[model samples]
Target: MPGLSPRPEAAAFLRRWREALIGACVAVLGLYWVIFSFGLMIWIGWAVAAAGVVLGVAGIQRARFRAGSDGPGVVRVLEGRIAYMGPLDGGTADLETLRALRLDPTGLPAHWILDRPDQPPLAIPVTAQGADALFDAFASLPGMRTEHMLRSLNAPGGASVIVWRAADPAQKRLH
Candidate 1:
């Protein structure tokens, strides 16, 4: 009942995805109209536009369902452990409260890797403008310990990783 709410990050992702879908739909509609007026290849253009609209709607519906699902984000924390959700290939991971912080400077688009044994490392893409805020957030975690540096994956500029040890293991477990 509790672990089933939408997180702020997820909401933001949905918002951006919606905007992109709308833009794509508009473009597809314009193309459909142009092709219709030309009187050549009208059917093909209509099909393509229809497919685009269907796919866009499906994606939005999927995101909405995910946002409403009963999952890890629904829980409330008072004075126990704190867990942050991160995307995994198959499911999701509840990152440790705060263990260690590592910053790497090798990847081009730059990324922050948060390390924790309880969950897989969270690799967050970073921009120059967001680096300071990200660092501050990590530093502000309730109980963080060791930090480390890792190798980059051939990105252009550089990258960084941050590790934190969670204070409450119970609350940090992945749902």
Candidate 2:
């Protein structure tokens, strides 16, 4: 039973599994709707199926995310606002006003460099507490391709690369 025993330290990582299960269920149900919408209400079925796909994808992505304690500090996201209280740097950035986002993995822990007009860039460690929530928040950005962002995030480390920009140039420059 020694191998079956749980470690106290491992309990923290238990938070990661719940989101994935929910995502899987959503995806399965959505796929069912898509495949079974053969004769009736095809349009509505497809529409709902699409929404489910989005939710499922986002949920799975967030599930796979883990904000370990190795990072400098913690992050909090609430009501569309992103805040970071870190050691080397700390700041808050409004998610709705985000103009650009880049991932910098050159450091020990990766950071999501959030840029907004009239404010300094906020660098929040990707592994900070609540950073997993950013996945859903990020999906709301207009014109962002979900698959592309996910691929970039999983890409090998290198110089900071801008993964997303606001859909409207005016918003990018003004906000």
lDDT of 1 by residue, 52-153 (tens): 777776554333322223222222122333233323322223333445555444643344555656767654444322232243354346664313211222
TM-score (C-alpha) between model 2 and the true structure: 0.68
List candidate 2 segments past 4 Å from native: 1-4, 7-14, 22-56, 67-70, 170-175
Candidate 2 lDDT, tens digit per residue, 86-125?
8777988887789898878787677888998898888888
Question: How many Å off is the CA of 157 in candidate 1?
Answer: 7.5
Each prediction's Cα lDDT score? 0.46, 0.73
Error of 1 at 31 (Å): 61
TM-score of each: 0.28, 0.68
Local error of candidate 2 at residue 100 (angstroms): 0.6
Displacement of residue 129 (Cα, Å) in model 2 is 1.3
Q: Which ten residues in a row have the lowest lDDT in candidate 2?
A: 12-21
